[model samples]
Target chain A: MAMDEAGGAPGAAKKFLYVNRKAPYGTIYALESLEVVLIGAAFEQDVQLAFLDDGVYQIVKNQSTDAIGAKNFSPTYKALGDYEVTKLYVEAEALEERGLTADDLMEITFEDEDDDWAEKPSINIVSRADMAKIMSEQDVILSF
Target chain B: MATLHTVNKSPFERSSFISALNHTVPGDKVLMIEDGVISARKGNTFADLVSSALSDCSVYVLAPDLAARGIAEGDLVEGVQTIDYGGFVDLVAECDRTQSWL
Candidate 1:
């Protein structure tokens, strides 16, 4: 309901890539970026997310924040598809070195409206080289 | 005395670790503290980067910090020396100056 502000007149849509490089819960960077991504999606922009290094940990399942007394917002990521902000690029190298695997991440998907509403995965595991190329193609890059 | 280069940020979070490594001299020492110790893990993507710096700089990690993060000594990269607070103090005294990377 609050996202209505971003739905003002849609201008020429530009490619916006938000790069998340911080670990979840270490600071406010991870959650802040997600918030911006959700709010930004309302503008009819070509939005995407890139999770690398510690950023990959943001989507890890079974995240518990009770000890830290912080509100667990991990569940909020599942709502991104409702905002039409899919395309989450996860660096394969980041997971390998962190002793994590694709199986460890939360399942996030979106429905393809054009293809008779087929469900498609938003989490795309990509190589570092491919990540580099994708980043270069973005019209604007937002770092968090 | 050689310089003591300290990195307090996680390598994965920023370029601080790599920047510190790039600025080191052949005999300089690099110490990881706080979240910077994350890069010292043997299996992480940055392990090779740390290993490459070993030929030119002596790499160290704070044992307490690593323990706090639940990273075992055995899981660290080869040649990465683990030290206590006293060792950290000694490094500061042994070096000409201490430089920190945010």
Candidate 2:
């Protein structure tokens, strides 16, 4: 669905969008989807992550699951950049509705090897309309 | 004649919250946890619905989830109550049956 406008090149890297909506630790979706992304990173596809609704909590800083007795995998998110999955789209309305700001989230960065190996933030906060447009442009959408 | 219903999804995102509310008998309890706590926040689009549900069943929001979502006690719908995991366990023991609105 993403590369259709690009003449459907058979060997071209397909754009894969991971849509995250549920809150982390509340269900298996968030962690499961993260695992999928890490596993699929081997394919070298163009991957973009979209976090909206309660999914924004997935990246929120200082999450302690000790009381809940669940594994805290939030740290794994920071490692995503190492896999070359650098783009992250977070919905602004979702953060505002939840009384959160980008400052509340963990810092994730990737190095721009092409540009003198400069480190850059990976999270890109977007409006709902912008998020919709980004989703429409993806070749594949994976909902979590 | 009482059942404790647990709703873990946001009412705005999933119909399960409303469906559980609709299926509740009088004297039932509806406890909001995880993303479901968002519906209990004051001035939300579903605030009126939650206020109405309080008349039919006791509505409670999990305290931890509220804190996680940055919802303070003062920000809850007028009639909503907040509870912690211990209270959650108490509700389960007090009720004859437990239903999960997934």
Candidate 3:
């Protein structure tokens, strides 16, 4: 693996898809997985975050971790844009099955560098089939 | 070009370890971490399953996790190696990709 001057991967960026299929709070997987994403952002890989199955609840708006005595990291999703980790794919079927829609999710966006810092929605509502195709195309898939 | 499969759950508690083992191919590597280190202990009930998989793939257990769980180095399965976090990072970089069986 070649490293650039900043000690980052120098070759072609690998496509990394983080598959989140588990619900948050109930387990540490979701939080720890997010930590990996944050750390991996420095690697300059082509990163895509996918929320499927019960994972859809992770981004639900108005999450109050107060009752659970856990530090709420929901706001971290909003800051992903600063790390250039903006692709957030939500599975359509997952939401429908859980009686949720895109409306229930927290609005996540990134500033478009090419568009004069115009804000663009980060969440891409995709069908399960399309998400599967995306998964197949990824060079690296990190599931949690 | 093989995948580094990470199993973080204990075999006695969950099926993540077995699922990871089942999905691993010949050249793939399995790294047992956290509670997954329990499966790597010598003389365990799952020793046969792990030993069988060792014939096809390499198995590793996180040293710190093993220590935390009071599993001595000598107690690890015959072919299983103990690696530090740096070794874990190297394994991830060496493999084509990684799959966290959480």
Candidate lDDT values, in order: 0.84, 0.85, 0.86
lDDT at residue B69 of model 1 (Cα atoms): 100
> Per-residue error at B44 for model 2, in Å?
18
Per-prediction DockQ comes to 0.03, 0.02, 0.24
Best by lDDT: 3
Tens-digit lDDT string for candidate 3 (A1-144): 222321344477878899887788998878987999999999998899988777888899999989889988888999999999889999898899899989999999999999999999999999876775566456778898
What would the per-residue lDDT of candidate 1 be over residues A1-144, giving only the tens digit for each residue? 112233334565677788787788888989999999988887888899988868899999999999999989999989998999889999998899899999999999999898898999999999876775566455556767
Write candidate 2's Cα lDDT for A8-63 as tens digits: 77667887888787798879989999999999999998999988878899999999
- Residue-by-residue lDDT tens digits, candidate 3, B4-83: 88999899997768756655667789999999999999899999898998997999999999999999999988999999
Clashing pairs in 2: A2-A139
True contacts kept of each: 0.00, 0.00, 0.50
In model 2, how large is the Cα lDDT of residue B48? Answer: 91
lDDT of 1: 0.84
Better of 1 and 2 by lDDT: 2
Q: After superposition, how far is residue B80 of candidate 3 from its true place, in Å?
A: 28
- Residues B1-102, candidate 2: write the lDDT tens digits: 366778899987896676566556667899999999999999999899899989878999999999999999999999899999999999978875565655
Looking at candidate 3 chain B, the ten consecutive residues that score lowest on lDDT are B18-27
TM-score of each candidate's B chain against the true B chain: 0.98, 0.97, 0.98
